[model samples]
Target: MAIAVISGCAPLIQLDSDAQPSTVNQVELGQGSGRMKNEQPLAHLYISDYDSAAVQNARMSGMKLPGYKPEPVVTVNHYVQSLMHDLAANLEILSTTFSVGVTSFVYLDGDYQQGDLLGNQLSEAFMHEATQFGMAVTDFKTTDYIRVTPTGDFTFSRDFLELTQQYPISVVLGGTLVRHQGGVIVNARMVNVMDKKVLASAQAFIPQNVVHALKGTHSAPLLQLKASQP
Candidate 1:
């Protein structure tokens, strides 16, 4: 099934500096920093599901309905991945780096919201998007932890560290979708998992009224999450 939207629940993106904030300490490349061309570039990256503070509050709150199924994060992993492809293409980095994870992904919806929920989990939609995008992706569990600042900075949660031990990912893609007074702001980033450093980042502002129209769907928000880039 689609990601169940909760009123005022969504991730917020940080929009500041050429660098995106991360819990991982920022690393500056010195004159001898080996990350230059001809060196082994960090190519096998991971793209994570976008998340927000509002979504977490609802899930942690103890008074939800029995059938309540909160979309833990903004359901836009594959979309963000597509954005990554665009980023790499524009930056001329795709030839050097690409995602190195499963092409097939599986969903873990803890609640039994639909009789055939498995048939319609957000993962299915993402799989379709991946196919359409011609991205070489496969089935694997994709879970990431991130925190955001009031002004739109990103920080990796401690839990995300545990995940690194299991996967060989060194770099990742992340962002936030925050509900604001006017509209939503997307603070997307390409992050280094090892040092929690931001490599490339961008921000987009989505008008609130449009979000309202999409939210009315009450279905998978992923089906209608569209943001602009410049």
Candidate 2:
């Protein structure tokens, strides 16, 4: 009944198929200057920090510091589940005309107690979301769920990439869960592994009220996050 969610193989910096970094050719920039013009290819650039208000709001919604005291396990479970539900709903609404698959989710942490709970919650969320989009994930059991953490002095682990290679999933999800500014924030990034391109990115800012519910006291927050079909 108790799974060591945090006891994953190893946390390694693995690139999803779509996210494999492409070589960027550099050209000298400026007159008589040995600097490369546009030295960083726009493709190699992550987080361009565009002018979108929604994205800006997400960026501005900073993290809560030091993290709140670990709440009741039941409360954390509920909040995580609710988040999965909302995410699924949004995916369904967006998958109308586009081909979508709720494949796998990988979390970053070393706590198996917390990681196990989070992984189950995420799987449930993905399933619910898949239904909304009229997509059925056939290999849930075979699907890879990973928790990445460091060991000793090493900064990354090898098990992390192994799972990715095994699953060879098309959509990869990664992010963090933190308490910030009086609430819980789940910053998630969804990437298309095949092409190594970022398909969609989102940040869920659960206000204090939602946090209370997440802790088993209040109602789920009403934040609408819908992705348009490509």
Candidate 3:
């Protein structure tokens, strides 16, 4: 279930003013009448870009797919509520293992692909899982609409890191979801905030049976999913 369109890049790290001082002059922090005397560059804010063949081509060809529905901008409330519930659950679970406090989040590839509503739908489910685990999740969808730039990239890791450093989150998890073989797969990597190192990487696989259930049937979620962890 690899739904994400993969792109290549060098290993990522947060860009800082101290590391690249000239970047400060290049930053556009919105418009203003007068420039402030002292403006500090934000650090630990990671910027990333996500490009998917599905989304790019869908926009180009003006094509739509079956079982696809555009999410209404005016009424994204239901999706938000669903996301909150899932996020709460996820945070709750992490709390038992870690501190499980999340201040904010960013969705990199949420735009529709092939008229498919996978991104938003998956996010709602993910949020629900996070909430169930007992975490404080931010409303990134409403508060911040992380856009797909012309270069087809966006950044959120730096912000994630900053949150971790400030709040001293013991562990931080980040990942992507993709459609693969008529199903969906989520690949996640958990890192130690202090060391800034990856602690583990896991893949959540959704089988064909589970995918059918994703279409709105209650066919015993993950009933046939078998995984091994070390």
Candidate 4:
């Protein structure tokens, strides 16, 4: 018995049940026969409608030019916020149980008592973040009485006599700054005033560009000096 199979638009293929299965070397078409010379199948190639030049030009036009990306503008507030986030995560004590105070950051290599404008700014930033994070903060510089003078009225004072005699701070937030070639390294820790045990600690790096953004000199003073000289 012979079985006939038709596939798509190709000619019919006949198989005999009594004959042993064998390799097909030739396939008969309607008017011609295609011969298979080797086991490898032949590939048919056709011309496409796409233009290589047009595709290349389109890809080049969409590609961005190679250059350095503009560095993000970071400030003291940003660095302090990052540090505060890390510190908050490591805090083991309850915020309600401890009243916190922030001090000016000191340089690692300089005298611990002396600090720069950057340290002062960092302290201020930390104070703001601490309050925002629901921690009770003590403003030791705030005076008990507001001083009114012909110059101006002030509630905050550096004068120890005018300020409160004592602050109810149980935890002190302080840090040290290390100057680096790329940036400044800030190491912050919250310590118990009674035993000096650290409750939480955090560290962050400020980029050189951000640290350099701080203005060191007043232009008004320089202009006044120049005018006086003339």
Q: By descending TM-score, how would the candidates be arranged?
A: 4, 2, 1, 3
How do the residues 1-230 of candidate 1 rate in per-residue lDDT, one tens digit apiece? 01222233222122222322232121223455324233433223222223533224434554233233444444434344555555445433432234423121211232323222212232354345434545444333433544456877444332443344465555554344454556555455555577877666655554554444343234644323345566
TM-score top scorer: 4
Candidate 1, 188: how far from true, in Å? 0.4
Task: Provide TM-scores for the models.
Answer: 0.32, 0.34, 0.29, 0.62
- RMSD in Å for all candidates: 26.2, 24.6, 24.8, 22.4
lDDT of 3 by residue, 1-230 (tens): 01221223222222222333223222323454322224443343233223434434443555432223433332223334443444334432444555332222222355322222333454555455556555544433232334578887543533443233344347655455565564556554545677877555555544444444443234444223345467
Evaluation by TM-score, superior candidate among 2 and 4: 4
Where does candidate 3 stray beyond 4 Å? 1-116, 144-173, 191-196, 208-230
What lDDT is reached at residue 139 by model 1?
Answer: 33
At residue 175, give the lDDT of candidate 3.
50
Q: For each candidate in the order shown, give its overall lDDT on alpha carbons.
A: 0.39, 0.41, 0.41, 0.69
Off by over 4 Å in 2: 1-116, 136-138, 142-168, 207-230
